[model samples]
Target: MTALQSRIEGHILTPTGFVLGVLTLDAQGRIADISGTPVATAAVRDSGAPIVLPGFIDLHVHGGAGHDIMEGGDAALHVATLHARHGTTSLLATTMTAPQSDLDAAFAAMGPLCKQRAPNAARVLGVHLEGPYISEARLGAQPPFARPASFDEIHRLHAMAPIRLITLAPEVGGNHALIAQLVAEGFKVQLGHTTGSYEQGVAAMRCGATGFTHLFNAMSALHHREPGMVGAALAHAEFAEVIPDLLHVHPGAIHTALRAIPKLYCVTDSTSAAGMPDGDYKLGRHTVTKCMGGVRLADGTLAGSVLSMDQALRNLVDTLGLDLADASRRVSTYAADHMGLQDRGRLAAGAWGDVVVLNRDLALQAVLVEGHAVRLN
Candidate 1:
């Protein structure tokens, strides 16, 4: 059989658990079957064999390889290809808090690329509009162009490219009143960059804002009496995004969040410095520098991260003490389920043949997106 119709062997990670077997891919780039026998959980770590897991699905991505998503015009293509090499098979091109004109130009350039993914690049599932509708008081790393939420403007950008997810501050610019309406219109709204009270956050959730963006950084902190946005998320949110780079959120706090939120997932929130040497790069309208493994602005505020999905996975297992199976879910399955993508994140009959083959050390050996092998250097 040709390479497209392939058979991959490893400790295959399935919905229930890992199995020692071969995963067969059909001609249509779908998983035809997984034939094998159940293996002990300990074998996953002790066997020293190749490991096959579902391809990572990053819902929040800004850029990589010295490219920022807001740069537009083939920037997303380059960023997607860079992350695909790091085992991210699918991602959302995340934008920053910028002016309407800048956003329009960016969307015009990126909208078409989302529909037609470049070869060797991760599938651009859709856009994740991260700003132009946030709280000015909490503009962490984002450009200082925070404005009130606008339904009209959202529709305009959505027309340019399919905006699958949005990160907004529900308390700003009458956004609290718009949550239910946005959710009703089929948008996956996430709250972030806010100075809202815990009660205000809970109210927004009830109004249909289902997720929190990068929990516990720019938003209000948890207090015993007031229980700010972080408290609200811990107590109420079913799903939320977290940057597991250890700098964004402490490992202790991440442990608490994992217990509180059932579907707590990892996001890169990466900047243009990802996969590049330490130097200055563009993040929206600001110039950020990558130094000592983190990217920061001139004022020493973290602009974004240089983290990749593969490194994030290692951090979860090696630093955070999560088992391989759980870490896989955080890096892949949970995000897919959050986005309602059943066929992309899991290994099941008829699902897309997106796989990540790793060595015993959990490093990327190879990556296949839709049954096509992606080259990794």
Candidate 2:
């Protein structure tokens, strides 16, 4: 028999549920087999049988590890590495509202890396184009670059790379058609940074805007009479991305969203200041200051976040009283399903070997992507 490639013995969080078992992987980055019986061979990574969960997949992330995706190239790798260390096995390299030239440069530089993931980096599934076509009223930490949708510009960028998601305001002129076109092109058009009314939001959804970006933070709030974008998102969106940093959004609001939206997932929406000491940083063209666990603009507008996926999970489980299984789904399964990623969310046969090992206390112990162990430090 061929020598076993690698075997991990632990309490694993499989799709079915948690189970104590030995999970083996093949030479290729796929689960070769899983056995309930334990072997005497040296366990490659023994953590007193820690809880092993499917690696977290973040649908929205900006930058981390002292770098921003807008800087492109190695910056993408840096962001991915930082997130990977925090249990994110895969993520979308999210961008901010910026000039067309800057956006194009970012797309050009990071596109290839998306197609071919860098070593020791979290797999970049695609790009989340978060701005330049959103609401100026709701441009939280975004620069003054917000504008109406430009079909030609979008098409050009899409041609340059696989833009899996784009956030736009439904009220922008020609946006409904753009939403329809984006949907037709297989992009996930999301409503965000918008001041659109609930009716307009619903129309955009009908035209194929399937989700909301950073729900409740940058969009219109829910009102009893008007029902606004937030209300529309809760009432009609298939999935809504939320920042669970406990700062950008209140825990009570998160609970409301989880209760109302059928699928509510967490996103870091992090900036370069993440995983670094408190200091000044850049979020695209805007300068952001990092202090006391939050990143914000000069005017005190909350920028992205320093929150990681692991902390998000902890917030859901500890702060919101979410069960481990439910929190896992929110951080991993739901986001993967939303992106149509069939191979990385669950630890089952035929799935990519992306797993995160955690102590019973939920601290990250180890991470593996494509069956290869990553250097955490």
Candidate 3:
């Protein structure tokens, strides 16, 4: 981490929008200034200069580099480094449903990593506790240890690694009230892994649940009358996360979501197979195989994915027909807004100097986490 100030020239995507300019990073790793020069929008589309965008923020991440977060021992560091190479400046270390003892052990090893930035790695912002409070009926790729919400357990784990978000079933055992409590205490709560009806989902939102996890995957489907979790999210949600690997969610469904939710963001939901060739790898307790550019279980369940944030961005634009600006919002800005992190997402004065410099083809040329450059190759 350098204390010296730095600058980069390119087509910078600032908070107000895109402009041809120079972006300055302060010695302390916050955005110092951006000096803009007027240029035609069409000119930027074909510019040889780097296209600088806010670094990606992934709220749902399990692992990468052939290592699971549950494996402990520098695994999270390796995963963070691998993702940093792909432009993720910040991420949540997502956990799967597992026994309490195992969860405790994993947190015990990773909690400190959350508090500081490590070398050549994305900032381990916090934890996304994705399980242990879900529904057994909708375990998806999660292990089958689903249980009801418990305040004591939640507090204990939060004390370990500050949980930024949680995924659970509000219709299950006293969890609707728990959602209220978690929100009141400043935690972001999301509804998922459920057989909940539309009304239950609405009720959860009323109780302060702010988002949905991996929309339309493990959650219930929308029907003409029943209007399950998907229906609720599409009808009422302003914010939601969806994996855009083109395998977890179809391009057509993604287009529908784009028109429905205002702050629909993209996440990798990536696993240990992310940067590796096709082979078997650990995704929590389950062993998943990477084949045909996707990860799956022996039972043919779609496990996590081998997608990186850079590839996710490409899919949003090249395949899904979104413009670069809207695609940048989906991959970066909206997630930061959902997390209430003003300092991490945009290229503005006083925001963290987290950036990804891409070329005309939207390939990563450089990545920065708080002004520190990470290796791309």
Cα displacement (Å) at residue 23, model 2: 1.8
Query: Which regions of candidate 2 deviate over 4 angstroms?
Result: 1-5, 37-48
The alpha-carbon RMSD values of the candidates against the true structure, listed in the order shown, are 1.4, 4.1, 1.2
- Model 2, 1-377: lDDT tens digits are 12223877787767766667978888887887765643222231244677778899998888998898888667888899999999999999998899998988888988787887567778988899998898888888888888888878988988777789999998977777788877887888899999999999999999988889999998889999999999998898779999999998888899889889877988999999999999998889888999989998888889999999999988888789887778888999889888888888888878888888887668898888888787788
In candidate 3 the C-alpha lDDT for residue 7 amounts to 92
User: Whose lDDT is higher: candidate 1's or candidate 3's?
Assistant: 1
Model 1 agreement with the true structure over 1-377: per-residue lDDT tens digits: 11564889989999989999999999888999998988865678788778999999999899999999998788998999999999999999999999898899889988888876567889999999997788989999999999888899999999999899988887887888888889999999998999999999999999988899999989999989989999999999999999999899999999999999999999999988999998999999999999999999999999889999999999999999999999999999999998989998898889999899998789999898888888897
State the lDDT of candidate 3 residue by residue for 1-377, as single tens digits: 33433998999998767889899988888899999986654566687988999999999999999988888778888889999999999999989899998788778778889989997899999989998899889899998889998889989999988899999998888888888888999999999988888999999999999899999999889899899999999999999999999999988899988899999999999999999999999988899999999999999999989889999999988999888888899999999999999898788899999999999999899888999888777
Per-model TM-score, in order, reads 0.98, 0.94, 0.98
Quote the lDDT for 160 in model 2. 75
Best by lDDT: 1
Least accurate 10 contiguous residues by lDDT in model 1: 1-10
Better of 2 and 3 by lDDT: 3
Evaluated at residue 30, the lDDT of candidate 2 is 87
**Candidate 2 or 1, higher lDDT:** 1
